[model samples]
Target: MIKGSIQEEDITILNIYAPNIGAPPYIRQLLTTLKGEINKNTIIVGDFNTPLTAMDRSSRQKINKETQALNEALDQMDLTDIYRTFHPKATEYTFFSSAHGTFSKIDHILGYKSTQ
Candidate 1:
């Protein structure tokens, strides 16, 4: 977590790198911890490893526990994906894989509903 002032208003920034191997449990743990730190002025950014939705990837992927946890966390926290909030139908991506020959947007920026 980083603390600073933006336009004289105090803010908190949290950067994360969610593990792919244990994403389900890690997301659950992260959400538990975030419940205490997240606020209107908080911003969360990360490479979540798991896409929050099917549209976030270029290939068909099953809905897994990790994705479920992330989605639930957003609802419970009242957090919105900053990019998706603005460009709901966009097909942009942030990550690419050669071996799988697929593209996915695993990175995200999120903030409270009232923040944007």
Candidate 2:
């Protein structure tokens, strides 16, 4: 977790990059690996490696574990997926696999609703 003060207010932020080469429970480990106090003020931002949900990807295909852990973690942190909330129906990809010829929206800026 990255910690700093903005205008005299303490703020902590997390940049998550789940292991693409790792096996199952990638997000679970990423979420729990941090050793800091992640309150509602903390902001989570980065390339999560795994897409959070169907809307986060160009394909209509669903990703179960990724979605579940993302939602649960957000609930646990009382954070909001701001990008998704703002552009509900928009299709945007943060990453493109040149080798596989695919585009995916995996990176994100997640944080508390008040922060936005």
Candidate 3:
């Protein structure tokens, strides 16, 4: 957790690094704990280890239940993906897997919808 002031407004930033596997359940638990701490000024950035949508992954495979749960949790918290908000149609990736020969966007910067 980071605390600072921007233009006289207090802000909180949460930086997270989730495990490559079993991230969805962990993220859900984390969000549940963060509900009381996060506000409109809060910014959450992380390597979530799972793509929130089909567009975020290079593969055309169906989105998994765990990933879907993560999206629902973020939506329930009113957190919007900062990059997607600014570039809705862009297809940028943050992670590449040589074994699978795939590229995915697993990192995210999220903020309250009202702030964006």
Most lDDT-accurate candidate: 3
**Model 3 TM-score (2 dp):** 0.94
Question: lDDT per residue, candidate 2, 6-78, as tens digits?
Answer: 9999988887776675422665566656524666677778777766677766666777765677577666756
Question: Candidate 1 has what TM-score?
Answer: 0.89
User: If scored against the real structure, what TM-score would every candidate get?
Assistant: 0.89, 0.79, 0.94
C-alpha lDDT of residue 79 in model 3: 90
Poorest 10 consecutive residues by lDDT, candidate 3: 52-61
Q: Could you give candidate 3's per-residue lDDT for residues 6-74 as a string of tens digits?
A: 999999999988998898889888988989999999999999888877888899668889878888888
Residue 24 CA displacement from its true place in model 1, Å: 4.0
Tell me model 3's lDDT, rounded to 2 decimals: 0.89
How far residue 104's Cα lies from its native spot in candidate 3, in Å, is 0.2
Better of 1 and 3 by TM-score: 3
Local accuracy of candidate 1 as per-residue lDDT tens digits, 1-116: 89899999999999889886786568668867768888899898888776777788899677677677768878888988899889898878888988899888889898888755
Rank list by TM-score: 3, 1, 2
Residue 95 in model 3: lDDT: 97
Local distance difference test, each candidate: 0.82, 0.71, 0.89
